[model samples]
Target: MRQQQPAPQAATGTTAGLANAGSKKARPSVWKEYVKTRYLFLLLAPVLIWYAIFAYGPIYGIQLAFKQYQIMDGISGSPWVGFDNFKYLFEASPDFWKVLSNTLRLSLYHIVFGFPAPIILALLFNEIRFNAFKRITQTLTYLPHFLSWVVLSGILFIILSPSTGVVNFLMQKVGIEPIYFLGNGHYFRFTLVVSSIWKEVGWGTIIYLAALASIDPQQYEAAIMDGASRWKQTLHITLPGLLPAIAIMFILRIGGILDAGFDQVLNLYTPGVYSVADIIDTYVYRMGLTQMQFSLTTAVGLFKNVIAFALVLMTNFFVKRAGQEGLL
Candidate 1:
């Protein structure tokens, strides 16, 4: 009797129709998305394949860390030794602490000296009004970044050679003795840090420059209207704008605290400087490959990864608590 209660069948039909409509809304258009972005998917196929082959594929072998790996027995057939490998790492390994200390010190040196370099370069470059000159300077700085560590190490050797190198030649002109930078343990760490900065600072600046580009021009103009100088504007506006990017990069750098520039260190290091030069990666290489202590080295690697992961989490937590955005 009320508003058209009609037949029970009619009401059921209306309810069914509403249910169908609700069902349609709830259903995801996953297939439709694939069809619409099929070209983009095709473009991404190679990268997916690359990760599958080179990155994710090796995860299966991580079990080797817990097992006594035998070449004849293979990874799967290797007998599990449980925590023995890890025990060896902590209790028995002679140079474990030394290597760990070297790794941390090198990483700290890179972060302390290397991290701010690109930011400084970016700031200086941003102030340059001449586009052509800025581009030339940027290009010159960036060229070294593209060079391989092998090539760069060779270049360093040639330049720092005590007898024939130009650096030593200049030292002689200044009435100073030619110093073997790469060979002498006293200067090896210093050389490593400085060379690393030279090779990487230019490339690292690209991120900061990109961050700088997105900063609002109006902020600078407003600052100018308020009698702010360029220095004041940069200090107040530019750095604040760049803080998010800096925080993110810093978090990432902390995640790699154990890495310590493997390629650069490996290429530049010699037996003479191994005490100071040997990092986690080189130590693992020597133990695992050179000495055939696979299980021991794998345990060391696992320990490093755990610490790095913890550092990343801790860093992100502090960064977020400080009222800045973090990588998490």
Candidate 2:
């Protein structure tokens, strides 16, 4: 015999009913908040509009990379030429390898020598016993950061002049020949790297100084109580505390590996050192603006940006995996 079906229970709520209930709940409105703070929004409106117009707006022109662009035709009207621009850069450009190598080598040198100098300076400054001397030294070092590369380059050129420069004069005292610093390709890259370090090292120290300030005094005191020397305390407590900031800054540096300081290179380099000093930015400026190869220049710029984005993502991933704060 078949059993009789039980009577259906009364519905507490259907899916539509629950959704209606959710919609009807007294919740805060985003528009209401904006209206309440209308004055604040009004103040921010100009900055938002400025960024939309100038900063983010120009991204649309990236299409020029895939097109044969002309000033008369404009971006939208330019004829699309697909991958021809990229093909020309890799296959046809004569200075492609040399410029690429120079850029990479210079960046690597900066990372190797330049990155550590600031950290060491900051640590040394932190260890100074006299406030007056510390302030004087900091002021002297930081003054160079304000000088434009053009002015600084001129100063460097005057100092390194083979005939009458102070550097050559000093070399003569040591009975050694005056080296042709700017004329020689072998020394040009080294000069650029060292000069860049000198110019920016003090400015870079500012960040490390800030990071060092955030380190706890109690940690250092504890180390000292354990009979640790100042150097040991710095190594164990201070350096470890600064690691997160260093890692974040390093990730940012890695992201911009292609950007090996365009302004400095432009000011310091001449035809003699082009093989060792020319970088992608200078190359693009010459090719697109001077030679009128707009499409090819855009392609190179796009490639650099793509690589930068990839580097940032990869570095951030490794940072996260290593249990450290990342640039993201």
Candidate 3:
């Protein structure tokens, strides 16, 4: 009976071949899967193309930071200047330190005052049981966010005008002297912060409100059953629930510590308030685009980007180390 039996190796090979054939038949090809979702792919193609052309395409021009860029020579033919532009910025440019200081100080002021404003507004909005009133308040607050800084700055001029301004009129009635809010160096930074918060707080609160809505109603009910007051519930439950969202926003804000609202500052600032209102971005604009110090502007921009990137990384690390969620 054992005579002429197939060799053991031959039997094993046959079984292995059958198993591989089954797998080949079962597995779906990636290309086939893509073809199956071709409609989605078609819809996504334009966005992918847009990013490729606008966002990634400009990366090649970053080399201008190290080159003596000439309009005739163009980017490719421009002579390389290495780190001279950056060295000049740090050592040679007298305004660099002052602009840098203003940027940092303004950013710090925003973080201290601006960051908490939205959260507080959101919390206040959440406490309002009257839906109609709440909605109207939210709409009023968020409307400012859509306005161009040019328009807002014009409005500010009208409201803060020394002679005809509504604010000055009110101050005169209260026996206080008419103070030039925008023109005065001492008041310019404060006006920037207040105006920024006023414009953005409503929009920012929308995010926090969304986060608040996601917190379990049962937790609040249970807390009330345990005899907790509204303040206690907010302090213990609401704030803790908001920590994840707060951490994410904080990390993003840290990345913008060098920005200091270029549009707002540009539109609102004057020669009288330049010491307080000038920032890295405005300085870069005046130096690079206006003054045509192309290489130096590029270097300043590069330096700003590097510092921002480092700040984001460091901030994310600290946030995660503190057991909170981060943007990354």
- Cα lDDT tens digits for candidate 2, 30-122: 898889999998999999999999989989989999999988989999999999888888998898877888889989999998888998999
lDDT of each: 0.92, 0.89, 0.94
lDDT of 1 by residue, 163-203 (tens): 99999999999999989899988999999999999998999
RMSD of each: 3.9, 6.1, 4.0
Q: Which candidate tops lDDT?
A: 3
CA shift of 268, model 2, Å: 1.0
Order of all candidates by TM-score, from best down to worst? 1, 3, 2
- Candidate 3's C-alpha lDDT? 0.94
Clashes of each: 0, 0, 0
In candidate 3, clashing pairs total 0
TM-score per model over all chains: 0.91, 0.88, 0.91
